[model samples]
Target: MSIRPADSTSNPPPGSTSEATSEATSEATSEATSEATSEATSEATSEVSSEVSSEVSSEVSSEVSSEVSSEVSSEVSSEVSSNPTPNLDIREWIRIGTLEEIDKNGPMVVKGIVVFQHEGSLYAVENRCPHMGFPLHLGSVCDGVLTCHWHHARFDVCSGGTLDPWADDVPAHAIAVQNGIVYANPRPKQPKNLDWHLHRLREGLEQNLSLIIAKSVVALVNAGVAPARIAEVGIDFGTSERSAGWGPGLTILAANLNVIAKLDTYGQILALVQGLVHVARDSAGRPKRHMLQPLPATEFGTPRLQEWYRRSVEVRDIDGAERVLLTVLGGDASDADVADMMIVAVTDHFYLDGGHTLDFHNKAFEALAAIRPELRPQVLSSLIPGLGNPTRSEELQNWQTPVDLVSPLFAAFRELENQLGRISPATLASGTSDSPTDRNASSIDGSASSIEGSASIMPSQTSPLLTDRQTRTDAEKIVDVLLGDDPGVIVETLTALLTSGVDPVHLSGLVALAAAKRIVHFHTQNDFGDWIAVLHTFTNAHAVHERLKQSQNPLATRAIYHVAMRIYRDRFLNIPSAALPKSDAADRAGYSTDLRQLLALTDKQQQVAEAATWVAHYIDTGQPMGPLWNTLGHLLLREDAEFHSFQMLEAAIKEHEDWEKSTRSIAKDAMRTLVLAATRYLAAHAPTARELPQVARIAWRLARGEKLFAE
Candidate 1:
């Protein structure tokens, strides 16, 4: 029997399993079948020899004498002569050959199995070998065994059993031959194992690809504009100390994309968390830095991003322990924000109540050790205070914050230090205090002397950088840290400065002004409050400069008032409502009495006036109330003298509003502005003040244009 190889044009070689072979063949079977049929038809119509026919002439003549016999023989002969034809639909079973007629080593692609008479019997079995799915037709048949052409997987000819230990049995086909014709039943079920393997393979591929894509999205965000802009800002401010100097921070982020993308896996995730912590540690620990790259993508500078930033800076609601822990356990948090973000990403594992949560905390602690060893103890202290309830404790401890993790935080802090250092007394002078003796002894143009003289004449021009005569006389206390002598004061001042978004340039200049005046050493204690207040003062100076330049009306007015309110809050030690409240009426009354006395100071009185001025500006001109109302509101409700002044203000605005409608509206606006400033001031410093029935009544009357309280 002539057999042809499974059409290479249609099917690839069988893979490790029959299923793979079938799938490949199915893809190309249509074209191969067409080619085979065409070849067979052409062969049938082509040349044939007459010599063999003559040898059987008598038999042929006899058969032809019977018309049916003649027709059947002719048809059979024609089919047999076809080049590549394997007749598939003949009803007559005619004995042709034995099973050994076709090779067993190779896969039986075509005409591979046969039926033949042996000892007056006929049997049939598939000619293809089972192992490796190879063609049995390509190998030699021996005795009752069939071996594949490729890997020699042997099988029995009769029972289709495998002789080789590793070989599988070939299937048997129902075969019979009659009237010089052969027939076969070729249907068989494929092996079950092959199907299962294919299914698993497909599933694995899909899962892996999905994971890859998810990771890529995260990496892309990290490598985009946010990081780039931060890097550029860092370089500009001389804070970027990353290797290779200046370019774009995104480039570094992009370089890590591969690592970031693989973070879905536990090992990869751990590596990423560790890597980020390491980078943050390096950034924070280093005292000096090299230039870094510019930001990528212009769109990152969207107004929405700026808006988000502005809003975030104003939010001071984070609880004390969390804040303290973040600082103590997380090492200042200025440079390691991104590292914190990385840790947050792995929190899902912990949140699910899986064992992975412990692992997550372990890794987190490890990171803390590597990057911010100093903060570990503090953070632990803060966390321990509230860890009694497991759920709440875990929620608190889990790193899941979604802050921008921008480089600006670290850069800003660095700039703060740099600005402070640049204008530090060590750089510009020898003494700490801006004393008259020190000023006279210095050759630096006596700018300090001039500033002091101006300050004496107009407390507003206490700032050495005043340009306007009106402002010089009316200039609010730009910074009053030097007015006292406390390091704690400096800390508070610095903290306030941070809140106001004080920029480096203005800070440097302000420091210079202070240094020129030799004012720093004038104080006795360098405490938290003093630093924080000084910071507020510096920030107010910057705010004033910005608002005046923009002059965007209501918005600028609002900004300026906020600065003024900060100044006011620091000027008087107005207790914040957030502080521990008094236990009873007696304690509350006692505290109130003492606070009243504190407000009676002359300096505090001046601060109240300054706050009033800002509120007056806003209400009369329909300008931004800013921080004025809020700042003065607390003072008014907290201080007896200041509270009395509100009644006077009410009368003045009422009398002023007795004019025409427009004039009355203007007057009302001015009064409202003043009230608003006071309200805002109270809100910040003494929220409970507004809760007072009397204070609320006054606020309600002012808001509603009623004059129940003198106005």
Candidate 2:
């Protein structure tokens, strides 16, 4: 039988690890019954054969990826690790002549298995190297270990377990001899090892082993484990292992979780793997947290606890803040109280860490919500350190020099108390946050000062969708002023609205809409790195909007001030703002959309405008929103997107609903615009190395009993 390599063309060869998502075969197979054309494991091989991935051609089952990077260790290991009784029937077995004939030939390939004489016994294993799909038949067996010459990956001849973590285990087939006839079983019984898989997932996370994580996720998913449970393990490990608190990796994981239900199984697997691997990367090499405990004997009331928490964060006292947070949990601090306290701590600062502090706080809660409420303290405290030394925009030159945003913001915040009569937990979600400080240095002007004075940035908001200046409600005008160039007017509009008993939550959401407009209008012509600045502002604005819903904390309104100021600052990015995709671009809108056109656009880089336009056209026509989002979900999974891309997508989805629920004049078509924003951001970052999604596909196939090694 001709055996195909991993991820082969309509034929074999597969992917790369160190490999979050680089295996890029464009084919899918319903039944991969082909052989490796040239690519072998090592010189003897390649990764998964194109046959496997091209074989994937028949089943996008995942459309999950052309980035198939998983080692097909799942099936191979299932064979070696399981102990199912061999079938008694001989009809299904392949007879390889006699044992005497095997000894005379030294080793022989029969039906993709290499029958070999090792020591005094006969062992049969897959002929392809589980590492790269090279023929193991070409390898050398010594001291009972079969070593592939290509990568020097060694495996036990009898059990087929790999000696190297980088390489997956080679499958060991069951063999028996009757009347000197040696026969091998082609089908290996896959036992449902749910607990074992969970344990391995932890091992994968602990060791930061990508392939292990890949295999284990595929196995657990095959066992029908809830994705939330898998995410919980990663969250538990990620939060506890890293001392700095919830970082980008964990945030990305949570962000993806917000929309995991929107993805297909393939997309879901890819989304989960991307999130988990990021968590692993973040926790890797970082010292595990020392873990602060709640105060042992405190009779602290909610007021005192809130004050103590805020003071600790204020003094940059991480330890004190953690203890206070823990104390609240130890006592009867309701979830809302706990959330408000954290929100107050972060919001009091001017866009702390350029909004990361707020975003992280929100996402941590979202991560908690995704799993269980019981893991609250453990997840909540993970956000404390982030509040410690965040970059307070008030102290930054950008907020001071050309634009003195701080003094005015604090002044506007004076009426925050009068607006909120009741207290609530800071509502939340997650996002990326940074000023031009995070932009790459090579841009013509990727500097803090560059974003400071762009008068043109505010004018793009003149439209009703962006800012209904002529609209009736204070909420509507607040939206208009936020999109204006005058910082003083923006502050005055927000303050007067609050003083007039306007819901701070409703007002905060308007700022978020203005922030979203900044993104929807974000011009791709600016320094490529400048996208982060606008994204940070929007996500930060969105985080503030979410928290205000669950919280009546007046201090939380500062985030609103901070993001409004950030929106003012990011105006320059929209100097030549991207044009809104015309509603008339398509004949009529529908509930159905063809993903091929959209997917093809992502094949090349810098398709930001094209992608957003295409999505807008299809969506503007009558295409259903569900399938568009679903396809976008798959498209995102197929690429090696950065943390910010995930942030943009999730935040847009969450914010779109907020807009859709509104009966106000400003809310019209806001949902469509948010989708356009999401489309633009994703298009801006598409076509990365793409190694992670491939790994997801490989694991998925392995779990389904496809021998990628031989396919």
Candidate 3:
């Protein structure tokens, strides 16, 4: 992923890819990019910079300073936008004969360097324009400024600084005349520091320039900057700049960061870049958020703040919620307390924002963990606006009629709390509390108050289900019941687990395992959109798992019931559940374990079952997992995967790892479920226009001096 440094200042060469391939590389766009730009293809290619000399030859080795101007990544955008090149010549000083060999107003390219004589002075620069890889020789130089006719971006002759704010500074080379011999550096002077690259990364994000972003990503990562640091910048921008607050971009960023280490070098870079690109789009044209201050010191402790925060969220009061969150964060309340506050409120409404509320909350906290803990206030406050108005699932017809899941679940919560002897903060009655503490914990948790007088809905099977496990462990038995057809039994089984003093985290993990199974068992025979249904349940379970581990707050544990109810609603998707593909001796013959074949399965169409089949084969044969992880990463990184896909892959990986470490007998089966879940989800979204990964590939190849543009 690192780029080499060059001595002379010259334009870049195309990568080794074919002209047809590189031409399409310039057109990379995903479903996400198309919505962000009028012409995604054109917009992505418009910021190419010429820095090809860095990879001039394998022999000319100096191992360019890791500090070699971080902007050297432009070579990628510039080269790939054109045709691919096969041959490259490297030299410290490329001689251009004597003065007589140069024309008075000549625009001549020697070894990718453009030597020019302007105003009776000798100068040299890249043969192509720093913006879009257009031939610099085609445009006329006047008044000591280089202008690319394509975009009208103006650059200085000496310093290569941009005359226009929109265009980045061009790479300037060192030109000299000695002993009647004219010589120029093939490589342009690159920006010398990570800060410069970071600044450019911001610029790329600000203008939504894919070329700049592509280049900056290659440079910063190649320069050895930690992925978290880069993600922190995007995370900070995405949260603060978008008035809408915590959106898909940041979520994708957090999710990708969770599994980035499992990817190949190129995949790692692409994963991060994809996240940043989404962040840029999410915040594009949006005004920066005006942050609210925390309330002044008051008599309220963490419990009261928790109540007030939930109450504010319950009323859809953004300002009040933000103030309350900031107030709690500004006090001695730990991160756990902050998480409990958000989770209780999120669960207070069934599947708030279609489960995104909990997912975003989880991501925000995960994003916070990746950065400084001091960012807690800024990070947690962003969750307010999304909570202002979310689609409460309880009001939906399906959740209400066939099975009054809300009332029964609420009733179970009341009875469960009675046994546990703790008050919950989930409100059942549509009545708003006059004050934060006005309602008892039972009301806040939807436990004390009956849901339309439908109290007492505990599982009739709790007694027998716990004892007759078919030789399954307690965790396995609970998971089996969770994925079963009985909604009432599911609730009762969960209640029994919690009351039996089973660790709440273990229960939450089982719920997540059950949710993952829904995806594993999902049949393509069902509607395509149902994928999101299963995805929502798992992501919510993921958030619940994390929060439960953080704090076993009575209110936090309520989310488990909420997540289980969602799993029940998703039961229909598993009808005629897709069978796992098994590997027999014949199946292990040829290409069954091939990573390329697994990826190829995604290239054609929604190979949902086929992908799961491939993953199951890979795992069953005891093939190396590193390559499997790498291949799974390619499935997402290569497509125009939107928010949920990113969320699913990361969560699935985490869940799989969680199961692999468990002492349960079915842990192996659970791992296969998660792997298949992730693989199938990725397969469904695979083979998009593929414009997104093309950009990353081109950038990567160009940085490595692989051919990209024509000679």
Give the per-residue lDDT digits (tens) of candidate 2, residues 100-188: 67767878886567778766566777777756566788899999889998789999887788898667677676554433445454543
Residue-by-residue lDDT tens digits, candidate 3, 155-180: 77666777775556766665543323
For model 3, what is the alpha-carbon lDDT of residue 28? 18
Q: Write the per-residue lDDT of candidate 1 for residues 608-699, one digit (tens) a residue.
A: 23233333333444444323322232343333221213322221222222222333223343334324322223222322322222332332
> Which candidate number has the best TM-score?
3
Candidate with top lDDT is 3
Give per-model TM-scores: 0.18, 0.77, 0.81
Q: lDDT at 331 for candidate 1?
A: 34
lDDT of 3: 0.70
Q: How does candidate 3 fare on TM-score?
A: 0.81
Candidate 2 CA-lDDT value: 0.68
TM-score of 1: 0.18
Q: Deviation in angstroms for 625 in model 1?
A: 56
Query: How far is each candidate from the true structure, as Cα RMSD in Å?
Result: 32.1, 13.5, 12.7
Better of 1 and 2 by TM-score: 2
Model 3 ranges off by over 4 Å: 1-97, 108-112, 132-135, 142-154, 162-167, 174-190, 297-299, 424-463, 467-473, 585-591
